[model samples]
Target: MPWKESTTMEQKIEFICEWRTGNHTITELCRSFEISRPTAYKIIARFEEEGYEGLRELSRKPRGTHPNATDEMVVGGILLLKEKHKLWGAKKIHKLLYNDFSEEKIPTVLTVHNILKKHGLVSPQKRLRRVKPIHPIFDPKLCNEVWSADYKGKFLMGNKIYCHPLTIADSKSRFVFTAKGHYKENLASAKAEFTKVFRKYGIPQQIHTDNGSPFGSVAAIQRFTRLSYWFIELGIMPVYSDPSHPEQNGRHERMHRDLKAACAKPSAHDLKAQQRRLNSFVKEYNHVRPHEALEMQTPASVHEFSTRPFPEKIVRFDYDSELKVLKVTRNGSVRWGSYNWVYVSASLQGKHIGALEMGNGIWRIFYRNVFLGFLATIYHLGQAKLRSNLI
Candidate 1:
């Protein structure tokens, strides 16, 4: 006996009117209205209390809100924290609140954001669109399986001196291995900091980097540089992101953002002072700051040191017996015969390259599994003609 959708109000009025006449019991009226007995009693009670006005629907909202709502003191505390750590956003503030007031009630992230919005502290954030990578996803399964390196663009410190930051992090665990603020982005500066990190964290299976100086050379084939060669020599595969695409190295870039916000915003007066700030940031980044991607766990909680320790000296690889070996001379070339010297990379000098015969006279050369190029020796005038023999 559901009421017609077209005349619901009129039908309720007629039903109540019928009850008022005492022709039918409340239970029978409820069945006619397709409502429960409690609903019928409530309607009658409302009609008795407020006449026709009460018979109409009343507001369902509670007159009083729950007492567990955020307190004025909490609002004040959030503002105070926002003022103290001007660079921190709502999530960071919330995390700090939990850390500082573990025994007290803490507000949710959205609640904290609302409080900030009410106080005109937080501005409307524009969504940052990321360019999706079309390449196959490369995920490091364990800690130290892959490490990312980058040089955050140099910024002027308080002393008006430019400081080039060298940053490296564990890809899987989001653990920061090094965040050294170097004076320069040259090979010397990069090597020193990397050596320190290697001594501490051991070696990773692969080192991923942007195609930049010290890490790589744009002119070098395969984007290989001296530093890249050194990494390969250490048995670590050095990889690069696609050119002009920062999102390819997105994780390291995101860390750079935080680092910039936390430390570089107010650049230190000198290297020593800046290093101290970097030290503090590293401590918090690794041990205190929670990453949303890691299920809100700090990097230190999940990151384990790599088992492969850095060797005391450079390690060499022995080739198979069938593969022929060629020694790259100091001039960055191999003695193909008595007088013919063809160029390889200077970085490969004094190193043995394994030659695998492809077909005909053409042979493929490799410096420890890394492909160098193909070589074809053509004999002319009773001697091998170098010519365009390189394939």
Candidate 2:
């Protein structure tokens, strides 16, 4: 009855020592040791036949070698391909060889890994820790409803400075619209690329990005940057990932990985060469690469230009009679009453904002429909500090 997890040897010793007493029945001994009758018998017989060594556990690994395993000639073939394309991984190698050899004849990605390890071409990898998924919440039922945008980290070209890549993709289809190298990571360069993508593919309902510059700001209220304000002006809602959580925009991050491997590993000679590489990658990724999440279909097959075409000119915001409208001055302050002045964002200078009441004479402000911030409009002398909270 003293079943223990001390060691395999300890359990076996206990079982044998108890069995030697010859007082208990087989079923009783099996139950006492927390083992089946068959298992108990097998252990007893092994100890009797082969002594203490027999009680030790045997490997469950297959005794015979794999039937379709690569022999010396096939190993030579793998090495030859590896020598030819040194950077190609096992999966890529397996995909390459799968066509030439019969499915049963060619080795799998795992087998390829083993061969590489046997040859000292690769080291054994440590088990990766499992992390919780931070998948972005927006699920577009159809293509072009939600789009993702991010700047893939900068890399140096043959040019003197670094080049930042601005990548954009359709959320539903995973179609990468563009992955252009930028001379600067500032707004002007980003807007130029975005304008081209907008003009080409049309506008989406929302654009998801991380809480970073160009797309967002840390100091700004709601982290809405001027670039995001522009997106809002164009009838696009901007969504942001939680801070330090890259996996929230995981699909885009995965694309960035492929982009790094394909184009930026050994970066191109100049901006122009990098642009050419990106163009090639985009063509292959959209029209050729089969995405597993997309049921192994190409993104190009699923994506089409959005029906909500980009407007040539900016559309002015309209306020209904239900809300009190206040015009923002050059200094980004609204002259709320004869004496009261509420400050809005400098980005909203010369714009109109609607004031929505939130009870107790506390007014929440809006640039168009976005909730900017709050104001106690009745001018409680004690609440002068509340004005600083408005942006």
lDDT against the true structure, each candidate: 0.82, 0.81
**Which has the greatest lDDT?**
1
Model 2, residue 118: displacement in angstroms?
6.5
lDDT of 2 at 296: 62
Q: Each model's TM-score?
A: 0.76, 0.71
Worst 10 residues of 1 by lDDT: 382-391
Candidate 2 structure, TM-score to reference: 0.71
Q: What ranges in model 1 sit over 4 Å off?
A: 1-68, 100-104, 129-137, 376-391
Output the worst ten-in-a-row residue range by lDDT, candidate 2.
Answer: 382-391
For candidate 1, report its TM-score: 0.76
Q: What lDDT tens digits, residue by residue, belong to model 2 across residues 1-391?
A: 3346788688998889889999988888888778887788889999999998999889898889877668666677788877765655676566556545667667777998888777877745699999775557787899888899999999999876788999999989999999989977788988889999999999999999998778887666666777888888899988888788878788889989988988988899999999999998899789866677886677999898899989878898887777789887888677866777776766667778898776887777676777777776655652222243434
Candidate 2 lDDT score at position 139: 74
Per-residue CA lDDT of model 1 for 137-173, tens digit only, reads: 3688899889999999898898889889898899999
- Model 2, residue 86: distance off in Å is 6.5
